[model samples]
Target: MSQQDPSAAPHDDRPRGDPWHAFGYVVSGVAFYGFLGWLLDRWLGTDYIVAIGIIFGAGLGIYLTFSRFNRALPPDSSHDQHEQN
Candidate 1:
């Protein structure tokens, strides 16, 4: 039986950081852009701009969240090529 390394990090099922962080990003994006669109619609007397803004905001939020969180993750070492050699 091999002993566990004391310096190894503990395994966790959940990713680090506030669970609401991603949700907040998406909600804030939608609210902000939707509000902007609503104001634009009022100013320009248009009907569909608010809907467009909401869709755009949601897409932007998802992209932003993906870029922010996905890039920060460390590459998996379990498949490290050098270790197999």
Candidate 2:
């Protein structure tokens, strides 16, 4: 095998990812929370819980999307440094 080049650009092996994951997270969160809210509204006889649930779900979805797709990363250093080499 040929020896690897030393001066070549670093290989970004990380997956570039897709927008669908975030969409799914947000959509799924809204759906799940909305369903829960409907149930709660039925049981508690409160009409506002559905709206609150939707808002909460949106926020939760964004948080989860960031926490997940944003990548936990190799370490805190990864935040500051993009180039591994």
The clash count of every prediction, one per candidate, is: 0, 0
In terms of lDDT, the poorest run of 10 residues in model 2 is 71-80
Query: On residues 2-69, what C-alpha lDDT tens digit does candidate 1 reach at each position?
Result: 89897575454445555487788888889989999999999999988899889889888888777766
Residue pairs in collision within model 1: none
RMSD of 2: 5.6
Residue 62 CA displacement from its true place in model 1, Å: 0.5
Give the poorly placed runs of model 1, Cα more than 4 Å off: 1-17, 72-85
Q: Write the per-residue lDDT of candidate 2 for residues 1-85, one digit (tens) a residue.
A: 8887875645454445678878888898899898899899999998989888888898899897887766644545553476655
Candidate 1, residue 34: the lDDT equals 93
Please report, in order, the local distance difference test score of every candidate based on alpha carbons: 0.79, 0.79
Task: List the candidate 2 regions with Cα displacement exceeding 4 Å.
Answer: 1-15, 75-85
Query: Residue 57 CA error for candidate 1 (Å)?
Result: 0.8
Return the lDDT, model 2, position 85. Answer: 53
